[model samples]
Target chain A: MKYRGKVVVTLKSGVFDPQGVTIKNALHSLSFESVEEVKTGKFFEVLFDAENDAEAEKLLEAMCHQLLANPIIEDFDFSLEKVK
Target chain B: MKYRGKVVVTLKSGVFDPQGVTIKNALHSLSFESVEEVKTGKFFEVLFDAENDAEAEKLLEAMCHQLLANPIIEDFDFSLEKVK
Candidate 1:
C-alpha cells in the first residue's frame, strides 16, 4: 500500500520565532490593521509504500520524530491517508 | 470580534520541488526504502480582530491570495475561528 501523509511542525507556544514576528510586522504594514500576531510552521507531504495503515503510521511517526521535526522546541501533528 | 486563522500554502500538482526531492532522498537513505516523493509548504496562523467571521474570512482570503501564498504556482486554504 502507498501512504501519503501530511505533517505540520510548529514551534511550541512561548517559543519566540523571529521569522514569524517579522512576517507579523509585515502583515500589519499591509493594512491588516486588526492583525495581531502570527505563528508559522512547515507543512510537508510524504509519500511512501507501506504494508498498511498501521505500518504506514509507524513509519510516519518515526520520520517526524527522527528527521521531520525538531522535537526540542517544536510540536508535530500529522494525518495519514492511503494513496493508490 | 477577534479571529484566529490558519493557512496552508502548497505547490500545485505537477510542480517540481527540489527541496522536497532532496528531503525524499534523505528519507530514502534513512532506510525508508518505500519512500517515494515529498511535497512541502508553509503553514501560518494569523490572529486579528474583526467584526465577525465573514469579515475575518474576507481578510484571510485576501492575505492568502495576495501575500501569504504565491499565486503563480501555489494554492492556499485557511480556516477561521473566533478568539477571545
Candidate 2:
C-alpha cells in the first residue's frame, strides 16, 4: 500500500522570526490597527507508496530526522492519508 | 492597537516533493497501515500592534508579496488577529 502525508516544520516558539517581523512592520505601514508579533512555519505535501500505516509512520520519522526537520532549532510535524 | 498574525507558505499542489517522497518512504519503515499520500502546509502565529483591521490587511499583503512568499514557485497565505 502507498500513503500520502504532510509535514509541518517550524522554529520553536520564543525564537525570533525575522521574516515574520518584517511582515509585521509592513503590516504597520499598511495601517493595520493592532499588530504585535509574527511567526512562520513550513508545510509540505508528499505522495508515495507504502506497505501499511504502521510502516509509513516509520518512514516519515526517518525522513523528518534526516531532511524534513532540523535537529538544531526547527521542529517538524506531518499528517498521513490513504488515497480513496 | 496591536495585532498578531500567522503566515502559511507552501508550494503549489502537484509540485514534486522530493523531501516528502523521501519521508513517505521512511513512513513505510514506521509501519503506518493503509498509507497513501502525504501533503504538507505551513502554520504561523504572529503578534503585533496595528491601528485597525484594514490597515493590517494591507501590510500583510505587502509582507506576503515581498518576503513571505516567492512568486516564482511558492505561494503563501496568512491570518491576522488583534490581541485582547
Candidate 3:
C-alpha cells in the first residue's frame, strides 16, 4: 500500500531558538507589539510505499529517528494515512 | 485575550525544494527504498495577545504576509486558539 505522512520536528524545550527570536524581534519592530513569543520548527510531507499500516508506521518511526530529526535536540511526531 | 497560533509555510507547487530532494536521496541511501518523494516546509508557533479572535486572525495574517512566508513562492496557513 502507499501512504502519505506529515511530520513535525521541533527543538526540545530549553533549547534556544535564534530564528524564532529574530522573528519575534522583527515583528516587534514592525509595530506588532502585542506579539509575545515565536517558536519555529520543520514540517515534512512524505509519500512512500509500505506493505501495511504496521510496516508504514515502523518505516516512519525509523525515518524520523534517523533523518527527519536530531533525537538529541529535536523531537519528531508524524501521522500517516493510506493513499489510493 | 491571549492566543496561540500554529503556522505552516510551504513552497508553492512547481517550486524546487533542494532540502527535500537531499533528504529523499539520503533516505534512499540509508536503504529506505520504498520512499518515493519528500517535501519540506516551515512551522511556527506564536504566543501573543489580541483584543479578540478577529484581531488575532488579522494579526496572524499580516505576520505571514510580511515575514512568515515569501508570498511569491510560498503559501501559509495557520490556526489560532485562545490561551489562558
Candidate 4:
C-alpha cells in the first residue's frame, strides 16, 4: 500500500527563533497591529510504500527522527493516511 | 478575542522542488528505499486579536497573500481557531 504523510517540525519551546521574530517585525511594519507573534516551522509531505496505516506511521516517525527534523532543537508531529 | 492560526505554504504541483529532491536523495542514502517522493513547505503559527473567527480567517488570508507566502510559486491553506 501507498501512504501519504505530513510532518510538522517546530522549534522546541525556549529555543531562539530569529526567523519568527523577523517575520513578526515585518508583520507589524505592514500594519497588522493585531498580530501578537509569528512562529515559523517546516512542513514536509512524503509518499512511501507501507503495509498499512500503522506501518506508515512507524515509517514516518523514523523519518522524523532520522532526517526530517533536528530533535535536539525541534519537536515533531505527523499524520499518515492511506492513499489510492 | 484572540485567535490561533496555522498557515501551510507549498510549492504548487509541477513547480520545481529542489529542497524536496535533495531530502529525498538523503533519505535514499539512509536506506529508506520505499520512499517515492518528498515535498517541502513552510509552516507558520500565529497569535492575533480578532473580533471573531470570521475576522481571523480574513486576516490570515491577507497575511498569506501579502507576507507569509509567495503566490507566484506557492499555494497556501490555513485554519484559524478561537483561543481563550
Q: What are the per-residue Cα lDDT tens digits for candidate 3 across A1-84? A: 999999999999999999999999999999899989999999999999999999999999999999999999999889999999
TM per candidate: 0.95, 0.61, 0.96, 0.98
Q: Model 1 lDDT vs. the true structure?
A: 0.89
Off by over 4 Å in 3: none
DockQ in order:
0.86, 0.45, 0.91, 0.92
How does each model score on lDDT?
Answer: 0.89, 0.68, 0.95, 0.92
Global CA lDDT computed for model 2: 0.68
What lDDT does candidate 1 reach at residue A24?
82
Across A5-78, the per-residue lDDT of candidate 1 in tens digits comes to 99989999989999888888888888887888889999999989888888999999999988899999999999
Q: Candidate 3 DockQ score? A: 0.91
Residue pair clashes in candidate 3:
none
lDDT of 4 at A39: 89
Ranking, DockQ, top scorer first: 4, 3, 1, 2
lDDT of 2 by residue, B7-57 (tens): 777777668757656655666666543335555555666665556899777
lDDT of 4 by residue, A1-84 (tens): 999998899999999999999998999898898999898999999999998777788888999999999989999988888888
Docking class of 4: high
- True lDDT of residue A57, candidate 4: 85
Task: Output the worst ten-in-a-row residue range by lDDT, candidate 1 chain A.
Answer: A24-33
Q: Count the backbone clashes (under 3 Å) in each candidate.
A: 0, 76, 0, 0
Off by over 4 Å in 2: B1-7, B13-43, B48-84
